[model samples]
Target chain A: MKPFSTMKLAVAFGTAALAALLTAPANAAIVLGGDNGWEVSYGGFINLFFTQSDFDSQVPACAGPTCSEDSTHMQEGLLPAFHTLTAKSPEIGGLKGTAQITFAPDSSGSKAQRLNKGGAMIDMREVFFNVSGDFGTISAGRTLALFQRQAILKDMTLFGVGALVGPDGGGTSLGRIGFGYVYPDFRTRFTYKTNDINGFNLEVGLFDPQETTGTAAEETDTPQFQTEMTYTTGFEGGSFNAWAGFLWQELEVQASTGGATGDIESFGWNVGVDVKMGGFNVVGSYYDGQALGTLLFPNVAQSYACDAFNCEEAENDGFYVQGTYTFNGKTKLGVSYGESNQDGTATGAPESDNSLWTVGVYHDINSWLKVVAEYDHQDSETLGNEADIFGVGGFILW
Target chain B: MFSKINIVRFLLALLVTASWSPLARADEDIWKSGLNLYVRLTEQDDAASGRPVPNQHPVNLDPAAIANSLIDIQVWDKHWFKKDEIEEVFSPEQARLLGQQLAIALRKASPGQDIVFAVSRTDTKFLGFRDLSYTAGRAFYSNDRLNIIIGDFMRPPDKFQERATSSAGVMEIKYYFRHGRRDDPSDFESAVMTGDGVEVYNEGGKRRLDWLVIDVNRASAARLAEEKAGEEANAPVSDEALRQEAARFAQERREMRLEMARMRKEVGSGQTGAESTAPIESRLKTLDELRQKKLISDEEYERKRQDILNDL
Candidate 1:
């Protein structure tokens, strides 16, 4: 019940929570160009999974004396079906521009009961435009925020399900949001990225401020700032990618309304590395911050625990390590484990921890199709609940 | 509410119908009888052993590669012709050099005949009950020319392993020399051009062609020119088709302009205070030049001018 309550709250605030994997090769997409130099491309994938989950007895839904501890459902995995359209403009006066729009639709409805047509939902997760020239690129509009972006992108669960919220949960299943890292939930921001120099690039953005639930600190005059730096290099048979990200923001607690009027400073930082050699890949990432929330950045609802007279910012940290081996350029086997811990500021509040283990097998039928089978075990220490889920699915990409 | 069987039947019907379509018939006719071209494998050399290998004939090339390369060649050369499904592949700079080497081989083969050259890949596929051959590369001959068709097939896997991994496939050169009727009436009666195949040697992962010799006379050249001219004059465009084309062009132009306007907005907004105004000035000059050239109307130019000025 506790895990479900937290998950429901996350679902309510996390709009189209999954981020598109940015590591797919550019040539994999379909591009249409004309003699006039402008080009448009279309790319995305649709995936569906049949999953059977076994929940903890204490977390089962009960009707009278009857209790149900297991459920089977056809649903989307960590990623919803995505359809993205990108348009690029010809270079004019040394400046080139691109605009992208992505739509994610759930494969199943939210209702616990089947065959509910009206329960399906579509989320416009990305609507952004960017301009680039010799200097760098400046992006505007809503997109995946920068904080902890690399961690999720590098997670093997990006291609397979790692965690399940519930049998009939809406949107996309949570891969490792609460288990290993906080969701970088897409946000509206204006960011500038420097041109790659010696395989290193820096990006900084000013995001629309976030609100803390029940903190009475909604009034914020300063935009939240986020920045990330990454370095990439390759050897004869291997490659490496290392990244670091930082986030900072301040919230003003209104005294006139209730509680003490003061500024609560929230900050977070993360570092991650990914290495690939021949057929093997390894990734490790860690994050530490205050008021950052265990599941979502800035912990919109629980960033700070407030009393009638004062408020204290909560502390959160998490890490995940994963490894995978690809065989003959087609099939991949992977395993990963991660944990996230939260220290609430409310007096005598118990520390909460969430962890997950995922083992998966993914096979590419061709360049545009893939099949996946996965098993996941998730544990919520504070709530004394656990779940085991098994799923099988396939994806069609264009 | 179609049943599953009905859906399957519908799909099968579509496939069968497509195989018998007019275009499909044309493709078959062209590859079989359109031109009297012949391709023969003359030599197979092993690069690793540095010896002329024997008894290796009819090498199978990747059908997909041949089809793709043929389509690319036809589009690039603006010449369309279908040949027997043979096989081959290459890049542009290498293609240019290969063309030159092919031209030299044609000169040596025919001595005095004008030579027209074309490169293409070959494809073979099976229809429901018949084997259909498709050739996708450029093929043309004109003005007393010796038409040389260089059909390369996929290198044998064993042979490929002998060369560097970066090596492109071996190119087999088959040259056709047309003899005049007056000089060789018996040869002209056969309707098939006679040619000699050159030995293709693989040296350091590159293909080398030996010289070829064949006989050519002048009379057969004019006949092929007339054939090419007839093929060059395609069907005339209908008035309705012209209207549709014009409308599509107009729509594309309108979209390009709208895209340009949006890009200008993005560029203007991204500018920082410390940045120089040189870029804005340069853009204005470019806009004026476009107007002077009548690329953009005066009214459109003025609107854009105001937008650029607003950026300042």
Candidate 2:
């Protein structure tokens, strides 16, 4: 099928490229003791996938009319190769502090380019410090946003490839981003997380806002406000996690050419649940919002779709359901289906829809290594295109 | 309408309420008192020195060695106390009975092995019954010494009118063991009644003491001789045979080491994937099925098929 628009694809890839690197399991760190009770840890993983996709219609990657319908390449999957360093200070006055930094590099360039220089560049994704005590934790700096954080973390495709952006795309793949939920891209923020109370905890943060319209003179009088509430508990035979998150931001926009002057208020809410029983895991999530855009918050293209004189808010909603069963505690087989839709505004534009089906098998060779095989079928009603993608990869962590 | 000012006020109120909630108290309050017993068995004489190994000081016991030779380790927590507080919880009568049962089980399990039992108690507050005094008793066994250390809080001794803390009680028990052994069973009986800090007992003295007799000669001479003969028969004979046996032993050791390394990695990293013998074949079969169903073009299928074969 025809691929997503250039702006949408860019937003999706940019969001995933920055945030997906930090999705590696945190417990696999190699810790080293330092003087005065300071400890340092190194962790992260490298994964590469050989992917092939067959499309039903021409995509951006096709520059000629006689271009082939299939494209094959070796690239990073949903997650790029990550290298992280963390430093933790001993508890002082009942408060402990920690600082972490991470670098993510992709492997998606051509052979000739690789010979001349590096295959791809690196993205500094996480640089944050946290102070925690009986009062809970306060974090400041750049990190993954809280909205839809749990939904993406619980996604089975986090460990495998879900959807391909394009034939020659770099960075990371979109692991059910638009199909299942909006991407909670990483951003600089100040957040406070309360200590867990009977398995219930809350997180509230003020994030740096993004420009909705690239061509407009936009002003944000207040930071984007976000909050998430999560509850986790374990029963006799299994455990489950449930969460709800909310987002709100208001932007005063005036066209650079002095044609439009109005306010666009964006608001979104999402709820999700993950249940793990024995070796079986099931996940379901849904999100709804107005002027929230799809794929990423305040999508620039969607904002442009609005009338310049009087902006009419566009409504978006999506849901995803996934189930996975781990066999013999080592091999996991999963199936996921999700769809995202954006309804036309008052101007009466045709609504657009994106949906995908993913089936994957993840096998652990050992604690530090895993092999993954995935197949994805993606469809776009707006573009009237369909694509089938197959990928195989493995991950290695320190 | 959900206004920004209203939303901000609501979130602030929620945060304030959550922070002041009683359930948000320090997590350390979750700690509770319990009884733990560890038992290990080793040769009375040191293998390298060929001399009697000194008894391990209760606090200086090597946990790794104990784990390697462990006969048993039992923990009696609140869950067990809930079921049978009188019999399972730590008390003078219960401790004595537990000591008796453990001595019997170990003697039966390993005949002719020297046994030692050491017990120490720490006073603590128990959950749900904070008004009632509680003691966390830790007991270890090695060599031939059987020492039982009771907390003064259980039934405060007349000498220490004030309830003794855990540290003071531990020190008092250590002093009794260092002074000398009180091998007589009557010594323990009297100490228990008088709320003494320590009660010492040994396997020496009359075998029929306290209505318990451990007959070490359960295995007859005929059975012992047969076992000796089987051990000798398995011994290597010629030099060539000995060399072969040595090589086989080395190979087995290497395999064991590799398996242990793999297990350690798995435990450290987390869960691992299951073993699959023919991943390539399975992948090929899947690709063929997709092609048959026309999900992929013939050209695409051939290219993927070639790629899989190239890995071979």
Candidate 3:
């Protein structure tokens, strides 16, 4: 199935998944089919961030009042409220069973101008099952893409802010996503993750191949291959986690003349490190790829390129580094700088380069509530524009 | 689009969560609740709103405020308390100041925790099944080591106090115990504590909230300041290691408790059996002498004296 249809199917499946999960009676374990070891629980957070942005003021205004025109309005932060349902089965024959369903209702304004006015549509993000024991864990289904998984999850801006102002505001803080690293869009796959040998973990998987734009035709039939190796250890003052990720996928785009662009290979690799000592934390991430867009682990044809009858591969590389200090336990102050540059592929082809410098402060009030404020200065070489955004938001995590 | 299947699914989910009650939960209550408030409405009110809580009474001048702190009942099992289950137990006015007051304290103690298991789960124990009363008051987990807060109280000092004999005001105690550490009867101290608690509120009087401030008597803290302190000198360890160390530390603690009990019973007799007037310095000197005589090793001497002084 095409990626777009598969996404729609995922949404369809997600709508019913949460009902069963959220409705499960509050019991220590939701044993089914006499599964004594089965345990189920639900957890999630609700976040809403209102923002105001002042672009270079060079771009012309829209002719009429349209939902997309308003940049100074209440918008959902990059990460919307998400619901997770988890079930774990006790060790049976030395192996345990794990299943999870994660869904985030669309709060972005893409469907409607007023927030929440666009009735929520379940965006099922993760639905997977796994069985594991001492050897390791092998999982199959839909979940986070292996590439750049650690970097993005460790991105503090994930819990803070990043990217465009609205319509959807930011769908799960892109945190330098399109600018520093390609968003590792979710994919269906079968994966194997080794149990930590010492403090090192290794994961390798086969993913469903995606069709990139500008290709003459769909040609490759093989699955995409990806792998990640991470090392985690703790010392006197703090701890550190570092990882490297790589992925390769073949692409084919069909031409209108019923011809094919034959075959093109896309490959990307990312490396990142996270370190913390006392009240301060530092994160650095860098990635380089061919045929990969500047930011996204790329979900669109726009990120890559297409020639007369073939897809043109481009060299892309970007890096993001952040430093943050925690105040007592309730508040944190942080600043980050990042840039993503995609080398031009053709004569006069747009050379896309994007960079962002940002500072943010977050305060956790009690256990359920949090308040955050951030300011971002974004420059896009491709668009030849710069935007400054200031935003403040609150979230209730249950 | 309100598809029939979607509607049916939503209904089923709502019913399931609605039917759940932690008190009537499965073998393992997934709710992970604090203090068991499972009692009659009248008993619940008395435990919650009653002045001079039965055994754990406050020494703070403002008893009402202490009452509020000990039992800030937000939401309880509706099935359990039907008659006295107030919809609005704490009015907005009462909780407003409490909200502001506890914000900084909670942040400091729990840090990133949105749900402080320590403060939220500690329950009021009025369960008088004498034989099962142990099961009623505190819900202690074996794995729980590093200071699982059991709320605050103004304890009555002197020999009557369950934990301490000093009047360092109403201090909160982090109950530390092992499954079966005692072999005899006279052991007094449960755990040798250190460091006073964090200062929650010490301003004048009316608006006072005592947070985690565990300063055991200053005199002992001063005298024992240089008793070859071992535990204090080590790096902060994991709660698991601490619990293990705490369990092994029980043996010497028994000796200290027995020795202190014997000394107080025989030598220190006052009109009222209150705190010992003897400077803890004297006790440390006695411990030093014991170590010199090979009665106790240096490690045992330091640990026991620390426990004895904390008990004092």
Give the C-alpha miss distance for residue A343 in model 3, angstroms: 0.6
Best by lDDT: 2
TM of chain B, each? 0.18, 0.19, 0.18
Q: How many residue pairs clash in each candidate?
A: 4, 4, 36
Q: Which ranges in model 1 have alpha carbons more than 4 Å from their true place?
A: A1-35, A57-68, A111-121, A213-217, A255-261, A346-350, A381-384, B1-312
Among all candidates shown, the one with the greatest TM-score: 2
The native-contact fractions of the candidates, in order shown, are: 0.00, 0.04, 0.00
- TM-score, chain A only, candidate 3, equals 0.83
Candidate 2 docks at the CAPRI level of incorrect
Give the alpha carbon lDDT tens digit for every residue of B158-246 in model 1.
Answer: 11111111111101111222211111111101011111111122246532221111112222233233234334333354665655555
Better of 2 and 3 by TM-score: 2
Q: Write the per-residue lDDT of candidate 3 for residues A1-398, one digit (tens) a residue.
A: 24545534653465345334323422445566465767776667777777777655223553333412336656566676667677777775667767777777745554343345344556777787776767777777788788887666666677666766232343445556766677776678777776645456677776777774435345445567777776665432356778888777766555523232444567777899988775688999999877676656545354445555545667778889999998764678999888888887662234678888989998876445678999888877644556777889887765
The positional error of residue A328 in candidate 1, measured at the CA in angstroms, is: 1.1
Q: How does candidate 1 score on lDDT?
A: 0.56
Model 1 RMSD in angstroms = 27.6
